[model samples]
Target: MRSYPVDSPHAAGRILALTMIVDGNLVGSELAALSRSKILDHIDLDHADFQHLLKDLCEDLLTSTSHGAIQVDNALIDSVLEEIVHPDLRRSLLHAMWSIADADGWLADAEAVLLTRASNAWAAETNFSSPSYRRP
Candidate 1:
């Protein structure tokens, strides 16, 4: 995957896009939830830019595919997760991810895996003890 500056809008958008596709399908409900939440605006990313980032992420993942199956590199995902350094940004992004995962009314195992991985990774860097971080 192409590199973007730490905490850059592109990085944030890429992560969000990854969340949308982690389940191997991008549903309309997920897109609608993202649009309604306006989370991209929080990172100064417009819808057009977000779509571009999503496309770029898809291309990157496709390039790394082997034998017709996409094998996502954990190191690459970690690097992208590390790009968002701010605690507030991490929290917001996590929230957006959870929202997207739940948008279709069913959380696939793949979605849960990505969400758990991101939450654990970010929790190690920042204090997530607050009740807000708890799932209802």
Candidate 2:
């Protein structure tokens, strides 16, 4: 078995592709923030590399995040989200989460909270729904 570098830039396209799946209500600033936030947290995430990883990641996530009610129900949706965030992809997800939260390089309290909830949820063994922050 060959172990891959966790911070390898090869996955950049994949990240963007996955993120592109989720349509609507994603403020462009937010999405751009998300991408940037993820890279910032991972010291090795070069801005140039992200451009590449995004394509495949978005490709992986396209159908799953397709337009819909911001689904908080349905086992299938959860499963799909979980599948989309598979362990390998989870790194990218975490990276993306940080990217969103840290995009501006100033961590707002709310964004910090959001990052904790998401990264923690994604890191769980059984993949429990990420703890939520009440809607503002």
Candidate 3:
């Protein structure tokens, strides 16, 4: 798990930024869903900013994976979650993650693991149930 808290000032954008990386593959629907997401607004970002950040994050992930397998930075993610004290916001972030994972119509094993770890971590932090991603 590579630490991406790499001095990014975009605290809220980290969830989406990390989501794009966790699956190891980026699909069109995921990008589309992310772009259409109102969650981005709640994260203090818009579609445009999200796209820009995703692009950069993807590049970084690519660089990291060029060497070997990618891993989710659980500690870094938890640290990010720590900054978000609101239960609603944490739940929203969890939902956004599930949305990204399910965007491709199939949630890969790695994606599921990432979502589960994130949900558990968020729930532990907020003492609230993390949102689930239901297929449509």
Q: Which candidate is the best by lDDT?
A: 1
Model 2 Cα lDDT, one tens digit per residue, 19-47: 33333233467557654455434545565
> lDDT tens string, model 1, 68-87?
98866577778889899889
lDDT per residue as tens, model 3, 10-55? 5557667677666677778987777667777666676677677767
Which has the better lDDT: candidate 1, or candidate 3? 1
**What lDDT would each prediction earn against the true structure?**
0.89, 0.46, 0.67
Question: Model 2: how large is the Cα RMSD against the reference?
Answer: 9.6
Candidate ordering by TM-score (highest first):
1, 3, 2
TM-score attained by model 2: 0.35
Candidate 1: regions farther than 4 A off = 131-136
Q: Lowest-lDDT window of 10 residues in candidate 3? A: 1-10
Q: Local error of candidate 2 at 120, Å? A: 8.0
- Lowest lDDT sum, 10 consecutive residues, model 2, at 71-80
Candidate 3: C-alpha RMSD after superposition: 6.2
